[model samples]
Target: MISKRAQQLQPSATLKVTGRAKELKRQGKSIVSLSAGEPDFKTPQFICDAAIEAIQNGFHGYTMNTGTPELRAAIVEKLKRDNNLEFDAAQIVCSNGAKQSVGFSLLALIDKGDEVIIPAPYWVSYPEMVRLAEGESVIVRTSFENNFKLTPSQLEESITEKTKAIILCSPSNPTGSCYSKDELAALADVLRKHPNIYIISDEIYEYIVFEGDHVSILNAAPDLKDRVVLINGFSKGFAMTGWRLGYLAAHPDVVTAVSKIQSQETSAPSSISQKAAEAAYNGPLDEVLAMREEFKKRRDFMVASLNEIEGVSCFTPGGAFYVFPDISHYLGAKKPNGDTIQNSTELCLYLLDEFGLAVVPGDAFGEPDGLRMSYAAAMSDLEDAMNRFQEGLATLTVH
Candidate 1:
């Protein structure tokens, strides 16, 4: 029998869709997947080279429970250079990935019955992470009119005595919406008044922005540095998803608490992976910039093509590789097989079954009127996937 905590947690929806797509492919079907959040590009050569060097040098052993000194130093320098925030290595805790970093923070901070405020259309793991920590997740839904961003008033209204922390992911997972500096300042004004509520700033998509510079919450409200836990990793920016290396920077006390949790769990990530991540942090930006440019091109093409579809509407996202489109117009329409299209999950299943195109439904991300598609695949695959999306939607009979 599973523990109650395990029973309450939902498996990641993105992974489920990705798995289904892979299964279809194995069954000899031609499936185009837009489901995974991973970068399509290969990990940079220099980073890989570091890993090989580590192997050759026999660096394959357990590292410090927190992290290798070199990796932590690189992380500290990176935060200063990129985020304009300062942190000592003592305040950094490396984990298996940003997912673990986030989980550790939640476990360290949340007492039973504490509430974590999460914006809808969030990454699928946020709410589940809260549940695993025995904390209640309070969902705050954002709208298309506001570019799917949480406004200051909306945030202010969500806070309460039970609210222990708020998770802020700019260049967000499903929506790809980045908060502007001014927007962050407005949110900061509300957060400053509620000092008891901690801030979990997920900056995993930091280097993937298209429009402007990535803005960290600490940069927007330097006064709250003591309470902000900044989470980042090498997975997205360096195309090192398999490396499983991420780190968190917070107050020394928070870092210590998380380090203790991590010690008994994963201990340290792969020794080779830590070396590769250190190289990533200290390496050139050429490959990362190239990947960003490719993603931007895909974003432009995908948004334009999706808008051209009859019943679907989409907003151009500022960063990340995903585009969340409003597909409510097609809901309740009749399928050719006489089934009725209802919510986003039904729409996604219909698309996959009839069109062999894979996408994650918005219902899994806490918004039922939309769907998320990742453009991290090749340009040719994206082009084909969009065409398949249009074709699939056109098959629905008008209600």
Candidate 2:
């Protein structure tokens, strides 16, 4: 029998949609996929060149379980230069990916029955990671009116004695909303009252901001630095998704705890990927900036196009690549085939099956009134996707 933990853990919802789209493509269907979470851009040539050099130099051997010294040093410099945060090498732990870094943080901090506050709509893996750590997830629903951001009042109300930590994702996935400095300050004020609670700040999408700058909770509350586990990687920003390299910066004790688990579980991250990421931190940002500009253009086009669809309202996100449009107006509508679209999941499936347009359901991210559409595709693909998406919705008959 499978372990109960294995049985209870759900497969990634985003990957499921992507998998379905790929399966249809294998059958020669013209599928336009808008469900992927990673950037569509190729990893910059400079970063790849560094990886090649590492291989040529025979840098295959593993270093410390924590991370290679060069990579850790690069991370330290990058954190201070980019985030206005300071961290020593001893306080950093590198892992397979930002995903694993988050899971490791949860494992290190959470004991049985401890609670982690998650604001919805969230990245799908968060609650599952908490569950894997034997921690209860306290999901607080945010409002579309506020751009899907958690208010300070909501943060305060959600906290309790059992609360172990709260996860904050700016330039958020699915919603693409970036928190402002003032907003982070407000959340920090609430967090200050509860010093016992840790903050897991995920800044994996830090370099993709379009409207404004990406700000971490630590920037607002520097006093809380000792308790904040700052998570980031080279995936989204550097288009190095396949590299599987990420790291965390926290107090030395937290780093030690995470390192202990990582040492036993996966050992260190790849030596070659670490070298590539080091070059990413030290190399020029021209490619990264260019990608951001392209994403901004795509974001503008997607939001405008989606809003023009009757009953669909998309909030203009400050950062990230996804747009979560409120599709609740189409709920309870009947398809031409006489089937009812009862929820976001069904609506997404209808778009995929009928229109060859693949998007993720908001229900998978703890919001059922909307769905997530990624604008990370090429402009031509996005245009075609928009047409299919609009046509799919126009055909539904609302009761």
Candidate 3:
């Protein structure tokens, strides 16, 4: 029998759609996929050259459970430089990816039956990671009017004695909604009252902000540094998703606990990848900035095109590559064959199977009134996708 923990988890919804779309493409279908979560750019050449130098220098052996001394120092410097957060080398732990960093942090902090508060429309993996740590997830739904951010009042109301932690993702996946400094300050005020709760700030998309500068919770609440596990990686910003490198910074005690677990589960990340990530931090941000500009163009076109479709409303996200458009108006509508699209999942599947456009359902992110479409592909692909999106919805009729 499958383990109970394995049984409790659902396969990643984004990967599911992307996988199906790839299969259709293999069968020679012209599918326009907007379901992937990674940047579409090639890994910046300088970073790749750094990895090549590492290989030539014979740095292939396993690294320390935490990370190489050099990479950890780079990450420490990055935290101070980019996020205005100070950390020592001992407080940073590198892992296979930011996803693993989050999982390890949850395992280090959460006890059985402990409740970890998560805002709705979160990255699909957050609740699953909490489950793996044998903790309960307390989901607080944020409204669209508020850009789906967790309000201070909501944070306070959700906290109980059993609450162990909360996850915050800025330039969020699935929604692309970012939390401003003022907004974070309000949430920080609420968290200040709950001294026991930990904050897991996932800043994987930190470099892709299209609005004002990206702000970390640490920037707003320096007092909470010891309790914050800041998760970041080279995946999105550096276009190094395949490199499988990410790290987290926290109190030494938390780092020690996570290192202990990682030592057994998986040792430090790849040595080559660590060297490359160090170069990424040390190198200029020119390529990252250029990618951000292109993404902003795609975001503008997508948001505008999605809104032009009757009954489809899209929020202009400040960062990240996804646009979560509200499609509730199309739910409960029927196809010409008289089949009803009852939820976001069904609507998305219909778009994929019939219209050859693949996007993820908002149900996967704890919201059923919307669906997420990635604008990370070429501008030409985005235009094709928008056309297919409109044509697909026009086929359905409401009662």
**Off by more than 4 A, model 3:** none
Report model 1's TM-score to 2 decimal places: 0.99
Error of 3 at 7 (Å): 1.1
Cα misplacement distance, residue 97 of candidate 3 (Å)? 0.4
TM-score of each: 0.99, 0.99, 0.99
Cα displacement (Å) at residue 244, model 1? 0.1
Residues 1-399 of candidate 3: C-alpha lDDT, one tens digit per residue = 999999999899999999999999999998999999989999999999999999999999998889999999998898889877788899899999999999999999999999999999989999999999999999999888888889999999999999999999998997999999999999999999989999999999999999879999999999998889999999999899999999999998899999999999999899999999999999999999999999999999999999999999988999999999999999999987999999999999999989999999999999999989999999999999999999999999977
Model 1 stretches astray by more than 4 angstroms: none
lDDT of 1 by residue, 52-135 (tens): 999999999999999999999999999889888889999999999999999999999999999999999889999999998999
Model 1 clash tally? Answer: 0
* Local distance difference test values of all predictions, in order: 0.94, 0.94, 0.94
Model 2's TM-score against the true structure: 0.99
